[model samples]
Target: MAVPAGVAAVVREMQDRLDAMPGDSPLRDFLSTYQRTTTAVGQAITDGVFADGEWVEEWDVVFAQLYVRAYDAHIDGGHVPRPWRIAFDAPADLPSLRKVLLGINAHVNYDLPQALLGVISDADFADPVLLGKRKRDHEAIDGVLASRVAAEDDELTATGGKSLVDRVLQPLNRVSSKRFLREARQKVWHNTHELQVARLAGPAPYDVRLGELELLSAAKVADLLAPGQVLLRLAVAGFGVVLPPAA
Candidate 1:
């Protein structure tokens, strides 16, 4: 499948995938929420929510392609990233929330930096003015994601039948979602810088750094699978992985 050309295309692709999925497929959980979020993002772009709406639209398309490619790879029996493999292969019986969280873990922690790198160049990074605008627009996405959390929770509840415990923790979940997305994107920016440096150094260094990111992302997903309060655990451990120095 081709990478989407814009946010509207991204939303449509996600919806198409969701339509193709079986009703009980765990994959639908994330794709459903993601589709709605992407729709909101498209609307935001239309409403001039970001400083550079065009850049955001381009970046959003690039960012979404990473997830789309992973889904395609998994479905086609091709090579899928470790983090995405874990998420895609997770048991269908997993909670809808866990399934969605797993997808977010793989996409944000592993795919996001690469997506950032795709659109942001060495010159763009070096230019403080350009980079500042990019960062601000990147941060602007947090508002989009944060805005969808409550509505997403409601959707999940309607589908998955949340427990009383889940109801009690919904407020905390909303706050945690916002906090972690902000924190994760901050780390994503740092990781993108690390990746940009490695990319400039050469393919060898870039591959090594990317390999380390794969491991860190996979490990984080594994950690997330442990039994506990997912939000609380995420608050303590944080989201997104740091890229280690190239060996």
Candidate 2:
């Protein structure tokens, strides 16, 4: 019921499961990217990059378990969140980038707030010393994630395989070209703060708002992957090839 072995072990388990999946399985590409990204962040935690490394290691395990549980449930014909439902049911031909994005979308938009609440529910947010450390450590993850994404550019492009579109967009690897990774994480922190406030006000209202957030985020993912959004999707993909930010 728990990922007691921690983030590194959880990532290894995911990689092993991914390896055993059918070669053409739609889930493989996304899981591959996820595993790589997670491993990079896990290394940062292992290196004591965060102010409260133990807190981060524990939080990472808890967060990963959500995805692990959802994956198992989907495999066993149990219910999962709408975003995950879309991901698990994806057609084999869905683009590699889309698969990666869909997984990110589901985890950050739907699962992150809840995970944050679990990890920090008892925190005294009004205490500047305690709150500041939490915030510092939270933001520290962004740089770790950004660097990891950049380092994996070649692997990510290779995962796209030999499609003309993939080749054409090869130069535009988003991981290198844009600040999307950092911004997405920042938004997750913002959302988690909002959720914590709502939950503090009242559990009933918080439950209602959580449902609303889930539906809204799921709808966004659905729209992003919709067949009618090809041109828009392409434009989004094109952003990856745009120039990297200046140092």
Candidate 3:
């Protein structure tokens, strides 16, 4: 609905900072993609897209150490029988070793909270910023149903007690599309990546896995990091992944 602007991912604010910087500034190398990410993330949030709290932040953290692994893989994977020239590309400047080390402090300052501020529902008891999403979604869908703008599309349209039209009006069920969810998930992972990788180098001495980071299998890490990706999973889990207490 009519949210009083600035209530979400502050894309303009972020881009303005990037625009004010010099083109050759080392930050420029990462700024375009970084700013684009916030715009994408802001739109996703405004449209009711959402994901686990840590996902977008994680995406940023994942980026921090990914290239290092990719480069190593480019070298080692070539020592194989076929010797496929699996080239790995990266931004020339890449996030500064310092920026990556710090997890691009700005992303941690904004993205995760913005996602929550936009998509959180009343039932998301842990978050208060989005309590209004329930009301807004209700008014939006009520207006749609009242105006008869969005009709059933037949493909996978619900066929029982409540049709697509009925469900669209549910206050607690904010509408979401695969595309939106994908965007939301990306934002979360990006931010989480930043957070996790930063923590990997933080002075904390140790981390709580499953709490701070998720453990990944070696093969999965390879696919995710795309090459040499060091044992970020192992690094984060200086301890290890812990199962929750039985209910």
Q: Report the number of the highest-TM-score candidate.
A: 1
- Model 3's number of clashes is 27
TM-score sort, best first: 1, 2, 3
Residue 238: error of model 2 in Å? 14
Per-residue CA lDDT of model 2 for 1-247, tens digit only, reads 2222577688887987887788888887777877877777778877778998777877787788788888888889998988788877877687776677677778777787677777885555667798778878878887877676545556756655335765565555443334655655666777777776677779886786677667766776676577643334534642111111112
1-247: candidate 1 lDDT, tens digit per residue: 2222487778888888888888877788888878888778888888888998888888888889999999999999999999999999987777788888999989998999999999998989889999999999999898889888889989878876466677789999889888998899999998999999999999998998998899999998887788767887898789778876656
Worst 10 residues of 3 by lDDT: 80-89
> Which residue pairs does candidate 1 place in steric collision?
none
What TM-score, computed on C-alpha atoms, does each candidate reach? 0.95, 0.83, 0.28
Candidate 2 is scored at a TM of: 0.83
Ranking by lDDT: 1, 2, 3
Backbone clash count, each prediction separately = 0, 2, 27
CA lDDT of every candidate: 0.86, 0.69, 0.32
Indicate the residue-level lDDT of 224 in model 2.
Answer: 57
Report the number of the highest-lDDT candidate: 1
